[model samples]
Target: MRELTRDDVNAAVKGGSVFASGGGGWVDHGLEIGHAALSIGRPKLLSVDELPDDAIILTCTAIGAPAGRDWQMLGKDYIKAVQLIIENYDGKIAGVMTPQNGMSSTINGWLPAAALGLAVIDATGDIRAHPTGKMGSLGLASSIDYETIQAVAGGKPEIGSYMELVVKGTPARTSNILRTASDMAGGFIAAARHPLPIKHIKKHAAIGGISIAIELGRVIMEAEPDGPEAVLEAVVHKTNGRILGRGTVTTKNVHYSGAFDVGTIEVSIPNRRLTLHVMNEYMAVGDDEGTRLTTFPDVITTFDLKKGLPVSVGDVEEGMEIAVFAIDKSKVPLSSSVKDPTVYPEVEEMLGIDLQSYAFDKEKTIYA
Candidate 1:
C-alpha cells in the first residue's frame, strides 16, 4: 500500500481521460476531487493482494449523462454515498473501488478513502468507460441470485434536485432505477454500491487498472512538451494502439436521450470517412463503406490534434481536426464484466450495432 500524491492524481486524470473511451467524467472534476482528497487526508492505495480475501469492498461512482447542463456533484456527495452504504449495509466494509477508469471515475473512491479511512483498492469494474452501471458490475448482472444494494446522493438542492436513495434489487433492475434517479436528480449523481468480497473482486475486476491510467498519464505528460504528434505517438505506443483516422469532423449528431448522449460523428479524411457510433462513449468506429473498424471493449478515443489531448464525445464539434485512436480488445487487460456476453445486448440495442461479434471473436483483428 502507498499514500497517493498530487502527481499520481495528475497522472490519473490524464491517463484516465484516454481510457475513458469517450465519456467517463470531466477532467476538471477529476482534478478537483483528487486534489481535495489529498488535502483532506492521506489517501492510500492498496492492491487486492494486500487485503483479506473475505473483506468487503464497495464501489463508488458517478451515474448520469456527461452532457447534462444542470449536473452538480460535490466532493461531499461522493463521501455521503459511501456513508449511506456503511449506514445501511451489515458487512464490515474494508475498502473502496471505482466502477471504471474515467477522468473522475478513476479517482471516485479517493475522497471516501481519505475521509472515511477506507483503503482505495486498485481495481476497476471495467478498464474502459462504458455507458451503463451493469457494464461495470463485474458480471454481477449475470448472477440470478445476486442482489445489488446501491446508494445515490447529489444534484442541486436549491433547485429541488438533490436526492438520496438506497435500493436493493437485481443488478439490472436496480441499475435502471439509479439511472432514473440520476435524471430526476439533475441528470448526474454520486453512487456507492455492490459491496463484494476482495476475492470476488480479485477474480472479476480489472486489476491494477488505476496504475495503468497513472502510467499512461505519465507517458502523455512527458511527451506534451515535444508536440501533439509526440503526445499521440507516445499514447499509441504505450497502449499498442494505432491511429484509425485523422481528419476534420464534418458532422456531429449528439443529443441527450434518457440517461445517455446518443448520436454519431462523421469525420472526413483525405479519401475515407470514419463514422463513430455513440451512446455516452464512442461505441464503434466504422469506415465509409460500413466496415466496422473498432468496437466497444476495445479502446476507442479521439485526440484533439491541436492540443494533443484526448477529447470526449461531447467536446467534439463539426470541423474540429482530431485523430481517432484504437487499441484492439486483445491488447488491453479486460475485466470479467466486459468479457461477459450479458452486458453487450443493452449497448448493442442502444447503438443499433453488433458488438459481440467483434468483442468476443478471438480471431477477429481490428481491420478484419
Candidate 2:
C-alpha cells in the first residue's frame, strides 16, 4: 500500500479523463475531491491482494448526467454517502472502490477513504467510464439472490434539492431508484453502495485499474511541455490506441434526458465525416457511410487538440478542433461486469445500436 501524493492526484485526473471514455465526471470536480483528500489525510492505495479475503468493500460513485446544469454535488456529499453506508451496514467496511475510471469517478473513493480512515482499493467495477450503475456492478446484475444496499447524498441544500437516501433491494430496482433520486436532486448525486467481500472483488473487478490511470496521467503530464502532438503520441503509445480522426466539430446536438446526456456529434475530417453516438459518454463512433469504427467497452474519447486535454461530450462545441482516439477493449483490463450480456440490452435499446455482438463474443477471452 502507498499514500497518494498531489502528483498522483494530477496524474489520476489526467489519465482518468482518458479512461472516462467521455463521461466519468468533471475534471474540476475530480481535482477538487482529490486535493481535498490529500489535505485532510493521507489516503493509502492498496492492491486487491493486500486486503483480507473477508474484508468488505463498497463502491463510491457520482450518479447522473455530466452535462446537467443544476447538478450540485460537493465533497461533503461524498463523505456523507459513505457515512450512510457505514451507519446502516451490519459489518465493518474495510475500504472503498470506485465504480469506474473517470475524470472524477476515478477518485470517487479517495475523500471517503481518507476522511473515514479507510483504504482506497486499486480495483474498479469497470476500467472505463460507462453509463448506468449496473454496468459497474461487477456482474452482480446476474446474481439473482444478491441484495444491494445503496446510499446517496447530494444536491444544493439552499435550493431544496439536497437529499439523502438509503435503499435495499435488487440491483436493477435499486439502481433505477438512485437514477430517479438523481433527477430529483437536480440531476446529480454522490452514491455509496454494494458492499462485497474482497475475494469477490478480486475475482470480478478490473485489478490494477487505478495504477493504469495514474501511469497514463503521468505520461500525459510529462509530455505536455512538448506539445499536443507529443501528448497525443505518448497517449497512443501508452494505451496501444490509435487516433481515429482529427478535425473540427461541424455539429453537436446534446441534451439532458433521463439523468443522461444523449445526443450525437459530427466531426468533419479531410474527406469524410465521423459521427459519435452519445448516452452520457461516447458510446460509438461511425463514419458517414455508417461503418462503425469503435464501440463502447472500447475506450472512445475526444481530445481538445489545442488544449491537450480530453474533452467530454458536453464541452465539445461545433467549431472546436479535436482528435478522436480509441483503444480496443481487447487492449484494456475489463471487469466481468462489462462483459456480462445482462447489462448491454438497456444501453443497446437506449442507443439503438448493437453492442452485444462486439462486447460478448463467446470466442473472445475478455477476462484472462
* Predictions in order: lDDT: 0.92, 0.92
How big is the positional error of residue 320 in model 2, measured in Å on the Cα after superposition?
1.0
Minimum summed lDDT over a 10-residue window in model 1 is located at: 359-368
**Residue 21 local lDDT, model 1:** 87
- The superposed Cα distance between candidate 1 and the true structure at residue 192, in angstroms, equals 0.5
Clashing pairs in 2: none
Off by over 4 Å in 2: 362-368
In the range 1-368, model 1's lDDT, one tens digit per residue, is 99999999999999999999889999999999999999999989999999989999999999998888797899999999999999999889999999999878999999999999999999999999999998899889777799878999999989999999999988889998999999998788999999999999999999999999999999999999999999999999999989998999999998998779998999998889999999999989998787888988888899999999999998999999999988888887788888888888888888888889888884554562
- Tens-digit lDDT track for model 2 on 63-133? 99977778799899999999999999999999999989999999999999999999999989999999899
Off by over 4 Å in 1: none
TM-scores for candidates 1 onward, in order:
0.98, 0.97
Query: In model 1, how large is the Cα lDDT of residue 186?
Result: 74
How many pairs of residues collide in model 1? 0
